[model samples]
Target: MELKPLKGQHHVSAITANAKENYRFYTKVLGMRLVKKTVNQDDTSVYHLFYADERGNPGTDLTFFEIPNAGRTHKGTNSISTTSLRVPSDEALNYWVKRLEAEGVEHDGVSTESGRGSLAFRDFEGQRLMLVSDELNKGVEGGKPWEKSPVPEEYAIRGLGPVHLTVAKRENTEKILTDLMGYRRKGSYSTKIGEKQFDVNILETGEGGTGAEVHIIERPDLPIERPGRGSVHHVAYRVESEEELKKWVELLNELRIPSSGFVERYYFRSLYFREANGILFELATDGPGFEGDEDFDHLGEKLALPPYFENQRDQIEARLKPLETKE
Candidate 1:
């Protein structure tokens, strides 16, 4: 059975070595608002920071797990090799080009990819990043901007965009993308990474852009990637309701894909499973959002705890790092 095309991205979770440096590059450099301050749920010793548009909108969320001095990411198969943010137009991308260069950020000059304007760059810790100019899907990002950012809200990244996935093989993953998940075949393009050539097949969500793209590439000769800092931990897809999430769980079971059935993550419910290429994919609910515990105006100001961790708040607080916002 076919599942509904996901609403779009809920969040992209990655790892960073320095909490302070990660906070700086994402907010001060990238100009995203630090919307959430919390600890890793599984291991509360480290910080889980969320950077998004002013409102902490669903598709706009970019989160990090701070693991200081961790080894850099090793590139290979079954990994999200690149995360692209969409800006509205070529002029908006030009704005970023100047900003990155002015800030001494390393970037390749503006170029075109998948038939759209793109600017590629790396964060301080070598996380691959890109800014794509999407005229067709420009205005999809929801919410306002954090007024403090030096970046004019016009050129600020609207939200996450095409995630580039590398797999050792393609057919099974393509089935998962097209059959079970509700992505349509957008098209295919070829590019070279280093000396190796790759074919990227574009897949679009039902809602299309504004964090709705996945570019799947099969790199047959490469070994599997070893995850570390500067690597994407998982990409969470958006679902509208509990029923839709449960439907996805049933579909995964029917397809013989192992899934963690409807796990509660407090702010949003989740079900996790690996795609054929071994990249972890999460189905996350849209309701009971980030504003659940705090008021919209003051979300993520405090170290919010889950119900289980409430009693241990003081201890947990001491164990976690001293994380603060850009403001």
Candidate 2:
């Protein structure tokens, strides 16, 4: 009867065409701290960047792949269309919208679609992001706030409150999220996009998105998505420890869900797989985090690699460009 293997949302990874722009937007513009800067193990040419709060907490972390030359991503059902972050209040949301607009970032007006207040906008690389007002979690404040941002110090982005994923069918995806992932349908809201009525499902969470919440959208009529430049790379679920992760792997196998072998990611072990509905998901353990190999205050300063890649640090560093481009 217990199908949900994951405790809650661990993190969300997306592809970025420009490392410099992406880094600046997440840290400088959005006021999140650059937790880690490393090379992608799969592709050393691109940089793997993690942004989170000052402490580099689990649910607050958002990872990105920086590929300067990746082609445009094709939108379809397989892709994750939008990632939502929870803020403190509507006043905070309004402040962020104005701040982004003042900086010429461009955003939709304040609106209420699903009993939740939100401000939506697109990132530099066409990634759709929304800031929803959820006052449940009291996120740690204090970071280099973007000078031009309207979001005040007391009411800033807590972390990923709820991530909205678009899937091909409602049944299979819903089963995985609620049954296998341990999420409950808090409620549903509808919005008019073009000529269609988009149904959005909100899942309840105690932690308010720190491995605590997730939302799924049933876009049945949309075509399949092709993974590439602009699409989401993967979504990772959080667990308390390696023991919990191992339990999940065993549970998945018992349920007949195939998975990639366990991979030691230094900070955490990872297991990868695709759900029936067609989205890449990862089971990530939170432990020795970004500070494992580097100092807490000075994360994301230089190229950091796992122990296996230590021997080839030179080659790896040479292959990738610095995320902070000097103007």
Candidate 3:
């Protein structure tokens, strides 16, 4: 069966030790809107919080799964090392440099990465992140910033940009990206990690842009990452609908790739599988989004559950510590 190209990133889910702190940092400090305050569907013991642009658009979401007792991440290879968020312009990145400093967040001030201006930083848990300026971008337009964000709309994060993946065997991941997932080899750029310089390959899919690209850095010297708070859980790419997602499932099955099959995520359907390097990849639909259960004006104010979990709401609520998400 012929398959359609996957759109840019749908969301990048990370691990956070404290949901309360995560909410405060992303919503207050970064000025991202808390679009959904839900729980990890597979494991309802903890919270699954989502932060994004005003409307919780497809390519904008940066979500977290809370693990109260999680330890700090042991950073190494074979990991989704860095996630980039899009800003409107190079000027916006300059604004962020001051804002982050004033807010007491340390960052590597504005510098060019892969021909685009970028600022690198980490959350309290040391979750690697970057703000890439979209001033020179040409494809896959960004989402609107939240009008109510603490940061000015122009400088607010617009959406997710290229996700950086570090692996031991570049060929294994490259084959899956190009031959299996249909991503094209855009180009490569030189980057330095500590004292050593390495070439990072750029891969892009549908309507290529910062939003539709992935940067792969091969590091055979490092060990497999020991995941904990601030570590990325998985990276999901966009699919149009359940119909297209089912087709992907069929394609994966035909090629004998093991996957989670189809998972109804309430907001969207998903199919999960790991590539050759053991990094988790999820293909998620973009429709029936976060607005369905909550009002546009008051998203993430209350604990939201999918219809299937409605019956267990009482038990679930009792298990979770109250998180004040209201503005």
Candidate whose TM-score is highest: 3
lDDT of each: 0.82, 0.72, 0.95
Off by over 4 Å in 3: none
Per-residue lDDT for 228 in model 3? 99
Candidate 1, lDDT over the whole model:
0.82
Candidate 1 vs candidate 2: the lDDT winner is: 1
Itemize residue pairs with steric clashes in candidate 2: 4-180, 76-224, 76-225, 77-225
- Candidate 1 TM-score versus the reference: 0.94
TM for candidate 2 is 0.89
Model 3 Cα RMSD, 1 decimal: 0.6
Task: Put down candidate 1 lDDT per residue, 194-252, tens digits, no spaces.
Answer: 88776899887766764787898888888899888888999988898888999988877
Per-candidate Cα RMSD to the true structure, in Å, reads 1.9, 3.3, 0.6
For candidate 2, lDDT tens digit of each residue in 1-327?
333345566678998888888888887677777778887888877898887766567677778998787888778775677787767677887788777987778688778745567888877877878887764344222123323333456567666756777887767877776777776776777777788877777775434332355666777677888766656888887777887777777888888888886778887788888887878889888676877788865677778898898998988888876556322
